[model samples]
Target: MSTPLTVVCWNFENNGKGRPDLRAAGADLLRRLAPDIALRQELWDADAHGHKIFNEQTRALGLQGVLGAESCTAVFYNPAKFSVVRGWAQGRGPHFVLPPTALTLRYEDAGPDSLPFNAVSYHLNYASAEQRLLEAEWLTTWADKGWTTPGRSHHTLPAILAGDNNSYPTSSPGDLPLPDLNTVKNEPHRLHRSYAGPSGARLPDTRPDTAFRTAGLKDAALYWATAPHGDPSALSRTVNASHTHGPDSRVDRAYLTPELLAALTGFEVIEVDEALSDHHILRLTLNGDLLSDVLAPSMSA
Candidate 1:
């Protein structure tokens, strides 16, 4: 059996310029996913120039996690399930003062195997295409570096790269030269659905097809199809044009290395329509045994 891991990424869209309750709202959105780990973008903290909110809300919601980077880009993991091994942040200078923006994480699960996994959460600058390319280069370079741990040349643990990339996959139109706009002018056709299948089941299958071969690192990431709305039968928020800004776009994404992808049993993305922020959450599940592979350098690359 594959390890069962639920991972998600979301753009809270709260740049500290909106309503005061956004913090609470962001926390509420996470509450719905119940994910083992979560990566968030556009999150502001009291330390940043415009950020007035701290992680108080996230803490209040039982997701009390912290990273060295500022609040704009952050990671939250369940202490009950995993332990942090190593973490760092990138994109911190004034020239690129959006937020720390990128994070590299190494975590160990609580299971007997003590398997480890490396994951990163990043938010790119919403500037011109040229600028985005520079950021994308940085991410690709980092991914290429792989992960290293004590007594291990590389942590082969399944590596996951997730967050509000801001860069659309090749399947979508990333060629457009517009960066000022927050939404994509030509979104991929796959995002049109309001939810997943009737049973709310889909697997991670963002394989590289002819059309997606050159989409950069995004092509390296796979999206797990999931049920659109949570607990469809339960009382939840309804997602529509006005609320989520244009027919709900699944801009947030999660990716795993091909080796890691094969090790997992299932992965899924959740459409948390109304938990806190406008964006929906994503989830991924992996086989617990495969985690052991991560500890071996031969498996990490």
Candidate 2:
């Protein structure tokens, strides 16, 4: 049997200066997609600019906050369909204890391969390439944490690292390398990069296919074109003059392990000619039994 799971990754601007009706847009997207899991970044605290707007929007959508950091990255889900057993935050400075960088949880019918899966949302450093690389390294560390030995108990179980890694796939902008498909295919949580050719160039065609291995397992680089608002009558004025001839610009991504990928039902990137924010939402469908744990008591029918 297949289960339908929808996951959305988006960097909703914390300061609500871009769009006046930002909350409405978010609610509309959520309502239209109705995803089972949502990985969000750039979320400000209640004191922040758009926090109230976002809260109201999500509150209206009937989604319950399952896990989050002090108020940065967070995960939300449809409570009626799934339950959040536990969660934590990560990414506090060295001087202070880091927040739970990831949100860990289990669901009622999450599926046959019931391991604790992690859902992470983050905002890599925007201004510094060094910071971006540092964040990437941090993610690698995070992804490699429990995979050391199969039998050892992990602080957080097997996880699906999903978010906006501001760092480009290639450390620098204009080089291409043939990636190991074996690395990306048929493995549980194989580290995969969406862009392969260059750091600043649009996403390369060599990125993993949306469909790989099993009918349920798959991955892909979703991209699109967008530019600032321009002249009223000149169509030419609206197009981005620089990098206009490059492949799709891939700024958002998702990495599902073989086990989780096998649960994928379907996926798509919501194509927007123009986005309310600088980024677009990466949405996909996961079909299978919800993930639960061996330690938990069976739910009574």
Q: On residues 1-301, what C-alpha lDDT tens digit does candidate 2 reach at each position?
A: 5456677876665523445476566667667878777877765563246456457656866786633444556677777666654454434233211122465555657442344456666566444444454454455434433421234433334456566654334322232232343434422212223333456542323212222112222123311111132111111111111232322344566665444443444445565334455566777565545333231223210
Best-fitting candidate, scored by lDDT:
1
Q: Across residues 14-99, which tens digit of lDDT does each residue of candidate 1 receive?
A: 63246667666556656766777777677654455533354564565466455435566767777766777555453333333344
| RMSD in Å for all candidates | 9.6, 11.6
Worst 10 residues of 2 by lDDT: 232-241
Q: Best-fitting candidate, measured by TM-score?
A: 1
What lDDT does candidate 1 reach at residue 203? 15
lDDT for model 2 comes to 0.47
How accurate locally is residue 7 in candidate 2, as Cα lDDT from 0 to 100? Answer: 76
TM-score of 1: 0.63
- Each model's TM-score, in the order given? 0.63, 0.62
